[model samples]
Target: MGLIRKTLGTALAVAAGGAGYLTATTNLTTPLSADDELWSSRSFKRFNRHRNPSIQDVCWKSIPLSDVRPELRENEEALTMEFCRGAWAGYAYAPQRAIMSITNKGPKTENQLFDEQQLASSKYELGTRFSDHFEVVERTRNSVTLRGGGSPLEPGPREVDGLFVISAKLNRQAGTVDVGLKTVFFNSAEPTGKKPAPFFVELLHRYYARAMVDDGARRLTRKTP
Candidate 1:
């Protein structure tokens, strides 16, 4: 009986330790900057009434801007298209659940410009689960602003909208390019009061920030040798 009691106590301690480790690892504790904002449950409640709700957040990444700029200029259309398509598939975020296929509407022009009208009229498929879409509202030499959304095809009113602005600048003194990705999520329903950020939403933001950094780094690396 003494031996059995000791074994059970040991097992319980091990289980508690494992639980603690998992909680620590999954907790959203990423540091924030003056420019960054996280969407908390409270923010959601405040914006619940409007047709579009906004959750503003900012994330930054460093890359070889000099090397990337030339490539972007040379193949802006192709690169932008690839970025948008990959975004729906979860890119580096959720590889196993990435979108299976994507389609670009209208003529294949030298510059692929999908403004608000174009985006509103077109539809995309994400593994038969969701219909994804985006609109390129503005584009320039070093920046692009757009809005994206996804909706389930099944009989439900579930949908999500997002606004994203990506900009790249060369820090000549630092010898690096600073890329900033500002994102705003629109909620369909309003929130009731101030609440902490949802775990899933926080996770999504982190994944997206990391993915953007990775994508920029990959592009710069490819141009190196």
Candidate 2:
């Protein structure tokens, strides 16, 4: 009886720890800045017309890139795109992707989702599509805006409901690059008493957003010599 009780206690402890981790948000994760360009975007403005408390959040993590291969480090565009690719891969191939595949709706492999030719070109221009669901709305030297138009849990016509702005901005002063992901939702059915999303929904979204940037930073570091 004691052994069974101990085992149950341990399991409960593990579950509590995981729940805490998922809900925790650090200083790097925060509400979107008031002056962010997305606010001025036509699509953003249109979707927000109803004054719904659509979620707008950002999370950032920095990784040193000074030791990266000279060719990549010197080419700002290349470095930025590399991080973007890594970040998108993290989102597209995370454990959630595997769970989604159980229903035979998700891509069997990464190759099925990404186009080799487009990835090779690494030219992220306006209207560029990734995985046939996310479309690029803007691309600057350090950041790219991707508008998601499909559901990961279901397959059908693309429908835009939100966007993400991923950035790899070099901080010369710190000899590091900040990889950031910002989420702006166009619509929501989730309840929001005084927040953009319910407490539990915000918690999960924050954790997921941070994980995407963290994965990208880790991938970039692995590429560094």
Which candidate achieves the best TM-score against the true structure? 2
Residue 77, model 1: lDDT of 46
Poorest 10 consecutive residues by lDDT, candidate 1: 120-129
Over 4 Å off, model 2:
1-27, 46-51, 67-69, 91-93, 99-125, 128-133, 149-160, 188-197
For each candidate, the alpha-carbon lDDT, in order, equals: 0.45, 0.62
Ten-residue stretch with the least lDDT total in model 2: 151-160
lDDT of 2 by residue, 115-224 (tens): 43344345677766555456676778877887674543333222226778877777788887777788876443333334444667766777677666765666566653
Candidate 2 residue 105 C-alpha distance from true site, Å: 5.2
Model 2: lDDT equals: 0.62
Please provide TM-scores, in order, for all candidate models, with all chains considered together: 0.47, 0.68
